[model samples]
Each structure stands twice: as structure tokens, then as C-alpha cells.
Target chain A: MNRKLRDLGERRLVEWIVRRLEECEGASLPPGDDAADMLFRGRLLVSCDMLAASTDIPPGMDLRDAGFKAITSATSDIAAKGGKPIAYLVSLMLPPELGLESFEDLWEGFEEAAKLYGGRIVGGDLNSGREIVVDVICIGEAGRTASRLGARPGDILAVTGEFGSQAAGLHALLAGRLEDPEARRVVERFSRPMARVREALELAKTSAVTASIDSSDGLAESLYQLSELNDVGFLIDDPPISAEAERYAEKFGVSLFDLVFYGGEEYELVLTLRSKLVEKAVKAVEGVGGRLIPIGRVIEEKLIKVRWADGWRMLERRGYQHF
Target chain B: MNRKLRDLGERRLVEWIVRRLEECEGASLPPGDDAADMLFRGRLLVSCDMLAASTDIPPGMDLRDAGFKAITSATSDIAAKGGKPIAYLVSLMLPPELGLESFEDLWEGFEEAAKLYGGRIVGGDLNSGREIVVDVICIGEAGRTASRLGARPGDILAVTGEFGSQAAGLHALLAGRLEDPEARRVVERFSRPMARVREALELAKTSAVTASIDSSDGLAESLYQLSELNDVGFLIDDPPISAEAERYAEKFGVSLFDLVFYGGEEYELVLTLRSKLVEKAVKAVEGVGGRLIPIGRVIEEKLIKVRWADGWRMLERRGYQHF
Candidate 1:
């Protein structure tokens, strides 16, 4: 118990999986969250997101926060396309000498988060580790999946929350520059980044959104993804950065724009819509208390170029990769 | 490169995940697996399992085996209800210093198992570890789930494959009795278990399977589960043990019957059928090279008692709980 998860091996970690599920989340026949038995009326469209240790997690975090963030990663994917997440399942592979209750409590935390966002923890896998890897699969219903490909010329770009707070906080935490109350905010955001499932659901219900993506991989990368999916170019403007990020950048001499443009792990929803419905789209999310801020517009050109207060150039490699 | 995965923390480790999942699988919308999207149908089933290093995984195993085993733990739930697995996702939080490529290679193995079983993985999360944990979620589809609540007193009990091999092989490996070729089969069963999704699918084509439960939580425990659901009793006969298990039990001075009866994680299909179509049911699984051995029948009594060659007694501690 004295050792961290990094000191463990694969077989030694994932040995705690019980053979049978303990309970169900709903009255429906199928299980919920990670343990699911969904009845689909049509052809199924599914996807999985696997998060490894280093790139996605903040260091020295609690198991509960890690569990929350883990669900957030998968839920973010579900939120981007206007899907209502039905349930979530998780596979937690822990190191051999791990305290058993740590995982049991963590599983409960994961379940709470799923319920908080209107999803259930249905089922999951537990295995030992080369490293601690948590893989989440979220299932949702779709009349039509809002994709990044729907954006076209003149479509406006928007996000659900302020950018760069998590990024700047992450930078400050790593750089040892975070101080006092600001440190708590930055640390909290860094540790428990939330998914925008409710926001996406609201957008989908209104049918005003054209394209969408989450901010886990940063702004420019998501814009590029939208451009690729829709076969249209983008001219994203200066994104709205958090006041905390501005202050932290000033204190640490970090670039505020870089955090706004290319920082990762925000878990916010980035979407596109026609300018005509921009007000409606903004109102739809606001009624649900979900923020929607205009960032820029889709362009006719085939390249994604950003415009700041200064000048602009073609953007490249805004975030991370898993391969 | 030869280092193991347990030493890595969250940040360095998640970077490893970002590298592995650049391409989306079975995406329903654009920017697939990057954030939340539409649910593919009307509902989803969900669950989570925690893999313990000391209890779930055996020592001296390949990293890829962890990935393979993780899939089995999740998919077995789907198989229990005759659900077709559609997609899977994962979340990984690792200890500091875990090798990233080890994750890549393991993912390749996990992806291969899913493909072999006719499922795909789409998204996941990677973070740093205080302990290494791998959590997987599998999504499945069924017309009408063969629930545990449907069994009657006249139903016949059946199973798909021989049991006890994984327990015996794991015991041998842990106790240092493994040798080439002879030890390989047992070890393979332990390291690379398969879910009975195909058999479950075939079972779903008919209503003959009145109630079903996989023997993952040991045959005894699964029987109790069905009894609880149907509010009836189970009269299970002697379950089949593998030839390898028989040999290992003799060498290790343990009871082969005990292992087959009480051991879990066989990943085999089990169901309760009406006695009227027992012949047709046997033919059904046999037609697909999946054997349906009648181990017992459901009873009207409320107690779940099993019979051996000699006598019958009340069962104790029906299944294995990894905690």
C-alpha cells in the first residue's frame, strides 16, 4: 500500500474483478454504465476511448478524482455528437499490492459521476497492468449524430465554457507556480475536468447546431477535425481564455494565446452552427446553464488559419496522439 | 524499453494513450471517440469490473495477455444474456514510468481479440497511476434478453465448455510447475480466455433458452443467481472439468471436481432450457461446434443444491468475489 500504482505490473493489478455484477442501474433489462445490455432498434454505431496514465491524468491525484476524470473522457466523446449517454462501463486494471477498498471506493465514485450526468455505470473490466490503463465505452441514442463534418462556409464556431483555465492551471501545477485560492481552482479543474453531456443534449434537441467536437485535444486540433469531417476550411478567431489563465500566464511568463489555442484536457464542447441560429443555439444551452461563446466561423478555403490580435498562419499539431 | 508498465504516473502515461487511439472505430459521427456523440439506438446496457493485480492477474505473464483477459471480463456479461457485442472502450490510469509501446502492443492484442469476436473498440482515457488499473466496457445487442427471472422448474441446465483449466493452470504457474508445450495450453486458457458471444447470439435466435447465466462467478454462484432471479431452485449435476485440469489436480494434490465446481472465469455459455426441446437445444449448440452438456435441471424447491456422483449438499459461497 505504500507504493504507488507505477510500481506494479499488469497481472498483479487487475486481479480484483468479481465474476458477477452486483446490481443494476435501472428498471430496464440491460445493465447500466460500464455494464450494459442495451436493446437497439436499428443498426448500432459504437466507439471506445482508452486513456493511459501519463498523458491524460494529472500527477498525485486521488483515486476518486481519477475515476471522475476517467468517465469525463468517455462522456466528452458522447456529448460532442448530441447523443444522450445511456450508460458507461469501465475496465480498471490495478497493480498487485493495491489496497482493495481503494478500487471499491473509486468504482463508487465512477458510478456517482455517471449518475450525476444522467448515465449509469453498467459494467466494466478489471485487469493487471503493464501500467494502469482505464478504458471507457459510453453508449447513447441517436436520431442523427451531430458530427464535425456538418460545418460549412460561414458556419460559426463556438465553445461551451471558457478556455485555458485547465490548461493554464495544469501548466502552473507542473511549473510549481500556482498560489493560494487560484491554486485550488486550477488544481480542481486539472483534477476533475467534467464532460459536457448535458450541453450537447440540449444542442441536439434544438437541432440548431451544425458541427461539434470536445475540447480534450485543444481548439485548433478540433477545428481541423471539423474541417476534415465537413471538407470545409476554418478561420477560427481568438478564443475566450479564462481570467485565471491570463493571470497565471502573466505570473509565469507563459503565452496566454498558446493555452487558448493548443492546450488540452478541457472536456468542454466545441460546436458550429449557422449564424442565423447562433442566438437560438446560445439560448438553448444557456437555459440549461451551459455556456456557449462564439469563437469564429467556417470558411470556404480548404486550410485552417487562425487570426489573433496580431497576424496569423496555418496551424499545425495543436495537441496530442495515442499511437 | 524493457521496463515494465507499473512505474509510470498519469501524465507521461496518458500521452502513451493519445498515441495509440488516433483512429476511431465504428464511429457514429464525426470527431468520433473524441467526445460525446449520439447514442446509436433506444437504450444501452452498462457495467464496470475492477482488475486486481494480485487476485485477477497471474505472475510471469505477457503484457498482451492483460489486454486479452480484460476483454473477456467485460464481454462475458454480454454473453450471459445472449447479447451481441457491438463495441468496447477503455480507461487506463498507470503508475509512473510505464512503457508506452507496451500499451500499444497490448492494444493491438486487445483489438485483435475484439475483431476475432466480431466487436470493435472506439475510445478510452489514459492517466497517471497511484496504482495501475485497466477498465473496459463492452456494448452488446439482443432482440429479447434471456433473463435470469424466466427459469421454471422443468428447465434443463447446460454449459458450453469444460471448466477448471484456468484455475489449474494459474495455480501451476503460480507454484512454478510450468513447462513447454504441456504447460502452454493451460496457460493459454488463463492468458487468452474468450467470451461466448457467438453462442449467445445463436441462443438468442430461439426462446428455448428460458433463462441464462455465464459461469464466470463459478458454476455454483451462477446457479444461485438464476435461482434468485426465477425464485426457484437449482439441481445441478457434476460439471465437466478439462483434461488438463484433471492432470494438474493430480500433480498438485487438489480436487479436480472442486476446481470445476467452484472456480470462475471459464468464459463459457450457460443456459436453462425447457426439457421439451432438450434434444433441439443440444443440436443447436452442436451445429455450431459449441457443445451443450446437460449438467442438471431446475427444481421447484427454493434451495440451490447440487449433486455429485455420491451425494448432494447445500452449496456454500456460490461464486468468487475478487475483493
Candidate 2:
């Protein structure tokens, strides 16, 4: 007979979860207390993100990927602030029919992500709901944090890794191309997006970096946010499209520009920095085994412009919107 | 024309929310950053809770009460730890059809609760979903924290305020008895439950208190949790049922004992303290304009017993379970 969540009861389930968690760094009090206690060395950074099954999960995704995506998405925000993640508190709204095995798998994936990012699952809340909803609240620390409002007109605009992969992945998934290798890779990119913590931490150590944001809302949306926050604009000469994404876009007959500019959940770091320290920033990211790809420069025009081989065109300020 | 969430767009909605938020206390970095930053003077206490519309909200309850309940429920955990609330992060999963006015009202209620508890809404995540789901993560500070595992054999068991009110309220709501004064009071109690932060902080100042927990899962369930954690049992002589709850129970033809023992979401603090310092604990609670009602004593035995005027009976370990 298969055991269900109802068989174990809420308290028993919580006890089982508590037993499975290893002691995480910076945690003074763990799961058994009314609240987890932590000691932070400096300024505490906190970010929260919620993933709903109906809105966040696409086709060909399971609970484990949902769990992983939830944490990384929140951690990406912390990374954008150039903060080192210390602890996470996850609140799960699970349906009653959810199996005990599935719950364990979800938790395993959640714990795996926390360990990979050097953060611990310090506490959480579980409640019955109509669908699976995972809300992750991440806590971190930073000595000096980067802000979106710190970008200047003459700053260089850069991004880590490449874009359009997640968008391509979503397109493939929606098109039911699950077995294709390129589709699988892009789907994996969408499902298991990694936070740019290492690169952001390295960049934060230098005085070169000004404004930073994680590209959870696509490159164009992120640039628009940076522009709005700092009252500036961007002039893009190059758009970094990953080779795999390029292939997937071509195979799926999707526009490369649309994929790169409007694809959300990339989890790449988009940053602005002083032009003089470009080499230093590049070297710092390289030290972390990541490349800082400069795509554009902050401009005083207050309108985004992108240059192509044929001509220059003004890009519409559009991206994913939840509502 | 009425504005729907979809009409305003996520970015515009967020901008509206940011504009509405006043500068919160202890927030080094506020809403616009990747993560809100805070400086803690002592050990940071953290707790998270999620409320779903399908399960948590009752009949006739609006969005404002839902938001208030979400924060206060989480605040109860911090209070159980005898921590002073500093900041709160709320992640809301809202349906697209939800109006802008309703969203604003929900946020107003959330902010109201935070301010009332001496905390503030520093940051949050908003996403589209099928239903309204509020996940609240609270961060607080404590110099000397209370734990559920601290109860000792022979300690006196006490609770702040009465029980069964929330249960009575739920019953009345379900029965459609919203017009009665007693029902109204209980419904109000259930709708706007206050966390016992002030009383817990006062009790923490003295060395009298040992174990502490919030009565979120009804009296029996909370006691069972305390018993399991401390490796002890409780012998109860008095069950604190409020007069309003008693009247509501009688009016509804429900057992008073059942209502008191099985009703959840009370947000009352259940605590165990040294026998000699019961008076001191009571005085401390009184100093904070609250009352500490002694109900039982801890025993070395592993079974819980309840004494009535007629006879003594063993209390079954049963309460509300989400599954």
C-alpha cells in the first residue's frame, strides 16, 4: 500500500522533515523552535518569491523541478544584490491528495538547491491547499550591496553567460518536443536555473560594479527596470545569444531577438559598471569560471536602442508580466 | 472603468505598491533592492506561514482580513520565541481577475498588522495565480529566546487568554449565524487574531518561563507537541474557554470541551514555567496588560490527563491536522 500525506498527519510530516535536514551554516536555532534563530555578521539581505503550480509550472515539469526553481528564483534576487545566501525559509501549500513520496522528493530537491547554494533550510510552513504552491524566502548577508539605482549614464551594460535558452526551452516544452536533445537542454535551463551568486559576489568585491539585477524577467525587462530605477537608458551593440539557444530558436522557428529580449527565468546577472574597470570586472567574473559579456552602455537618451548588422532600431520596453 | 490587475500590469502594480509603502523601521535596504536589508541587534528570529483562500478563509471574510490573518499567524511564531518583530516579507499569489482596489485593501491590512506588531513590510514577491495566496515571512530579534523543548517535569503549565473563540467563530461562520452578538465577537476574534508578542516579551525577561508555543493547532495539539518535545506530560485542571466562546458553543449546541480542545488558530501563547515563579510570570503578563492563566502542571509520566469536577479522564492526543 502506498502511504499518503494524510496517513502521516501534519505534525508527523513536519517531524520527518526536521529529522532529514542537516544543520546549515549561520543557523543558531533549527526547526524544533517556534522560529529558527540565526546570527548574521553584517547587513541581512532578504528576498521572497512564490511559485504557483498553475502559473509558474509549464508542461513537462514535475514537483522536483518546481521545488528547485522556487529556491533558485528567490536566490537570484539575493545574488542580484551581491549577497551570500545563508538561510532559507520555505512555505509550501500542498494539496491533500499529494503523495508522501512526492512530498519527500520535493523536499529533497529543495534541500539539494539550498546545499548547492551554500544556504540551509532553517525553517518552513506547510498548509493544505488546492494546488502546489512553493514560496521561498531567502536570507543573506552583504558588506556593500549593489543597487539598481546606482547605474550612471556612461556605465557599461553587461550580462553573465547567455540568454534565450529559457525562452527556447519554454517554447520547446509548449510544442511537445520533449525528446529532442536541444529541447531537453533548454528545458533543463528553464527547470534548473542557477543563481549567479558566485559571479555577483566576485563583482561586488570590486568598486567597478554599479547596478546589478538578475534576469528573471528577461533582459529587456531587467534593463527597463534598471533604466527606470536610475533614470537612464541603454544602447545595445551586441546581444549575447547562447549557441544552444540559437540552435533551439532556429529549430523551433522562433525569432532570436524575441527569444533573447523577452525570455524570462534565465537567472543570469545583468549589470552596469564603470567603463574604466571593465577589465577588472571581467577578470573577477572569470575568476569564478564565468564570463562577463558586455552587451551595451548606459546612455543619457532615456530610450533603449539596439544595433543590428542591417540597421539600428528602438526596442519596445516589454517583457513578461504576471498580471 | 474599473482597473483589473491585468490592466495595470505587474510592473505598474509593483510601482504602486512601492509608492504606498512608508519607510519601514530597521530596513537598511528597502523594497527597491533585490532583497531588503536589515541590521539586528541580537539573534535573528525567523518564521514563515502561508494562507490559501480555499482553506484558510471562511465565509464572509474579505481580502483585508485574509492579509491580516496571514501576517498575525506568522507573528504568533515569533511571539512564541519571545522575539521582537523587526521586518516582514510577504509573497502574494493573486488571481488575474482580482481588482486593484481589493489588492490595495489586502496590502493595507497587511501593513496595518505589521505596524501594530511593531514591525513593517520591508519587501515582498507578487505573482499571478488561480487564487489568492498570502505567504508571510517574519524576521525578529531575541536576546534570550524561548524553546518548546525547555519544559521540565513539575513545571507549571499556563496560557495567555482564552481558547475556543476561534473555533466558535468558525462554527458560527459555517452555520451562517453572523448576526448574533456573541457570534460576531467570536467571528471577529477568528478574523483578526492578535499574536501574543507583548506578553511573551515580558515573560522572557524573567527566568521563570521554560517552554513556549503558539496555540495554532488547538490546545490539545499544542500540548501534545510540547509533551513530545520536552519528554513530559501535562495534567490539566482548568481549560480556559472564553465567556463568548462558551455562549457560542451553548447556542450552537456544541460541546464546550470539544470547542476548547479542538479549535485552532487561537494565536494564544501556551507556556510552561517553574512552579515557584508562577506569580512572577502572572505579574509580568499583567504588566503588559495581559493575563496569564495557569491551567496545568508538567509530570514525568508520558500520558496527558485532564481533571474535571466529576472525575479524571485521559485526554486523547487529537487536534486539527492539515492532511
Candidate 3:
């Protein structure tokens, strides 16, 4: 735990990985943001992820969550790419201290998560090492990939489901806020994130959407990616926060807007859509059992401005601090 | 460091990786073995390995040798499979303490090594981590892979180049025996190991080899593997030992047999050949500039024995220890 993991952070590490893997004959994008490209085979998608326990996943809440979170984590990227999860790989790094029970629970969670989504857990690794580093690389095919750069200046900004609940809920739970049974919802939000694969696919097929990104890191970070890629500004009106978030925000003494903007692990999607077909886009997303809430619109200026009744202000941090 | 990698040792980590990387349409042997299978455009063979400082490469070796050795380390497996390298992916995980000079030196060594081995350093990843782990993932094509299980009872044991040089050379360098410049040969053997790709390929083209495994893990381990795979026996009259091996034996007070039979990182091909193709095989490999040394013969029984002055004896502990 004392080891600082000196040198390149995740961003730089990812950049390096992209560069190397992309050189392979089938590597999708050399190295950059989001997910790597898969040479589409079946309409289904598969994604992979590796998490070093010391560096990636924190100390336990539930072991099964490892499996569930792994699946959901991969599925979230699939959702961002406007693809459906057909299957996933789960290479679990088991430390020597672990037991058979943990492995069984991990597999169980994997099965549960897959059934929750539409995919199944296929084959993966069971490697041992100094640290617990779980790598899950997935395969995904897109009907149409929703790139972050696809947003136009006038595109309508949107989000799937509510924001900030997980952040507030996590904070409250950490602060011994177990008095509220609904705190389980927030914990579950973090533990069992649902990838909006169907919604992403449906939206991608429509003419209404422009750009999309998964809100794994948080709303601000996802939006920053969209703006940076598209070279556009966002005039966002803070979207409606969840009830759990408002209560948890008060209990944790953290700002509701902060939770909405900077809180991460939401696994929801923040998307930009064509202004003229905003209604159509919403309908398309909702048609697939996903809620699309219009949060803002793209502006000509090269800034992500938060516009409220009081005044217009600049966001201090545009995205999630993944590193 | 004391931990067995599979018992949360390297094997466990590898299995964890396998689980996470679970089979997509493209990924092969996910996170298992030396390298994972990649679905590149061609019938490509790719493997990535990370060399650690203390564990893999001893401290203070030349950057060029490190680079050369890295390439050799990977190419050896391909050679065993009777494959020709097309290209390499080099990921040099540097400690932050290292600077531009070290990087340049490493790059120079890497480029030169790649060039010498007929592979291009197409791309790489540079990141800071705990140890200096240089991962080299090589991609090659097979005319016919000299798999581990192809040998039969009558197959003759063969090798390329002299053995025991690397271990003895390393010992001399570590003991400051540089005054004996002959030790340089062994040192060079370790630092600048060349793959037996040429020999493997030539053998494959002639269809002379029954089974093959790189002698990197030494003749004893290879014999054990080949015998196990073919359900045969191995009887070596006098396995090849490097020049100065006897001197090293005297200096270190170790049995010369131990260094030659069980020592590793040789990177020479321990190919199994039919008794009939001895001359043709020798000519075939020598024509490709790979000198073939026929060492022993296979037997009907399943015992793997080495001949000594007294009689034949079975080896106890098998081969090289990467840990």
C-alpha cells in the first residue's frame, strides 16, 4: 500500500498502451480516449479491462462486486461506443491470501452482471502475481460508434438518468450514513453500474445524436472530452439531481452541484444531440427504456459555461480527475 | 518476491489476466502462457514480456544488451515454434529515476537488436513502474510450428550453437573475471542472445523436425518436456557445453553438468529430429547459417536420462527459474 506507483499516471499509461497495441495489425485507435476499436465480427460487443487491486480497485465492499463491477465497467465503455455487449473477458488477478470462496463469488457476480446486461461471461485468465491486477479486455461491434468529436456547435446536451446520486451516496455511506436504507441504492450504483448499451445503440442509429461519452469519470470529465474533441463550448444548465443526492449532499456537507459535476463512477452517459431532432433523440433513447434529460446545449464559445438564473460562470474543472 | 507467481505468483497473475481478457472474437489464450493471442490481419504469433530489474536482467547491464536480450527473450519462443519474426512491439517500463540518456541508450540498443534479428521496432510504450519491466511482444508467422508434442520415440536430440555459455559468462562478469577476455563470449551469449529462428525455419521447411522447445530453459528441462510430450525417453551421450565451461565449473566449485544441463537463457533450439534426416537436417540448418549439433537420441521408454562416466542418471530439479 505504501508503494506510490511512481512514474506515468493512468492517462500517460493509457497513451503508451494505445500506441503499442495499435501497432498490432488489428488495434483500433493507436492510443487516446475511451475504448479501443474492435474489428466488428458479430453484432455483439466484447470489452476488456485490467485493474490492479492496489492501484485500481480499492479495499472490499463485496467480493461479488468485483465481478459485477468488472462487467459493468466494460459495458459502460461499450455503451459509450453505441454497441451492445455480447460477451466479456475477466482476467482476475488473485493474490495468495485469497480463498476459493472469493473466486466463486467473483464468478457469481460476473454471471449476475452479464445476465443483468444482455451479455454472458465467456473465457478469461486466472493468473497469480505480486499484486492483484485484473485485466478485462473486451470485444465490441458498433452499429455506429458515437465519437466524442461528433457534436456540432448547436447540439443539445443530454444525460441518461440522474447525476450525483452515487457521489453523495458514497460519501454518506463512508460517513456512516447507514441509517438510510436508500444508501444501498447509492452503493449499488457504484457497485453495479448498468451500461446503457441498448440506449447507445438506439441513439447511434438515429439522426438526432451528435456525440456521446460514458460518465464513468463524472459528468464534467465526459463533457470535457466531448467539447475537446468537437472543439465546441457548452452552455449547460445544471441537470436535476437525484433525491438521494440532495439528502446525501446535505449530510456530507458537499455541494449538490459538485456531486452532479465532479462525482464519478456513475456509469451513465452524457450525450450531445442535434438540436432540431432533440425530441426525436429523447424518444429514441426512451424507447429503449432509457431516460434522456436535456441538460444544456453546445455553444460557439470555446468554454464549458454553466448558465444559471443568477449569472454565467466558468467551471473550475471540466472533467473527472482520472489520475 | 518469495511468493510463487501461480500461487499468487506469475501464474495467478497470468490467469487473472486471462479471465479479464476472456475470449473476444479475436483474443487467443487470453492472459495465459508467455503471450496472448491477438487477432491481427495475418496468421500472426504475438507475445509480450516484461523484464524486471533484479529478477529478469541483473542490475547494470548495458542498455543495448538489455534491448538485445529483450528481443531475444521473446524471439526464442517464436523460434521454438519454428516461426519467423515479422515485427516486434517494445514496451520499456522505465523507473522515473532514469532520464533521457538512459532512454536514448535503451532505444539505441532496442533498434540495433531489432535490426539484427530482422524485426523492426514498430511501436512501444514508455511508462514508469515499480521495476524496469521491458515487455517485448513479438509477432511472427509459422511455416510449420515445431510444437512441443510432435516428437516420437526415434527422434534424435539436436541443438543449435554451444550451451552453458550464458550462465558461466554471467558468473565471470559478476565475479569481475573480465581479465579473462574469453569470458566475454559467455557474457555476449547472455547479453546478445540470438534466436534459433533460422534453424527452426529451415527445419520446418524440410519437415525434418518432430518436436521442438527452446533450450533457453536448458537441455534437461527441454529433454523432460520433449519426452513428456512424445511419451518417449531421452538419452544424451554428451550434451553440448560452452567453451570455458570447465573453467567456470572449477571456479564456481559447481558441477559443469549442472550449468550445461539445467542452466537457461540459452535461446538455442532443442529440436527433435528423425534418425533418418541427420545429414539433411545438419545441411539444412547449416545452409541457413545455423550450425546444428546433434546431441543424443530418443528411446522407447519414458525415462529422461543423462549419461555420465559411470552410467545414466535421471535429473532431479528440472530447469531455469524466472523468479
Model 3 TM-score? 0.68
Winning candidate number (DockQ) = 2
Please report, as a residue range, the 10-residue window in candidate 3 chain B with the lowest summed lDDT: B28-37
Candidate 3 lDDT tens digits, B1-323: 23322133222332332343223234322222112223344333444444555555665468768877878877777677777776565543344455445555666776676677676544332333344556565556664455676677777888897777777767766776666666665676677778877787788877788877777667777777667657888788876877677666776676777878777777888878888888899999889777999888888988877777588878664564321
Model 3, residue A139: distance off in Å is 5.2
lDDT of 2 by residue, A169-238 (tens): 8888889888999899988887888998898889988888888889998898898888888899999999
In order, what is each prediction's RMSD in angstroms?
6.1, 1.6, 10.5
Instruction: Tell me how far the alpha carbon of residue B113 in candidate 3 is from the true structure, in angstroms, after superposition.
Output: 5.7
- On TM-score, the leading prediction is 2
Pick the winner on DockQ between candidates 1 and 2: 2
Question: Comparing candidate 2 with candidate 3, which one achieves the higher TM-score?
Answer: 2
Candidates ranked by lDDT: 2, 1, 3
Q: Rank the candidates by TM-score, best first.
A: 2, 1, 3
DockQ of 2: 0.75
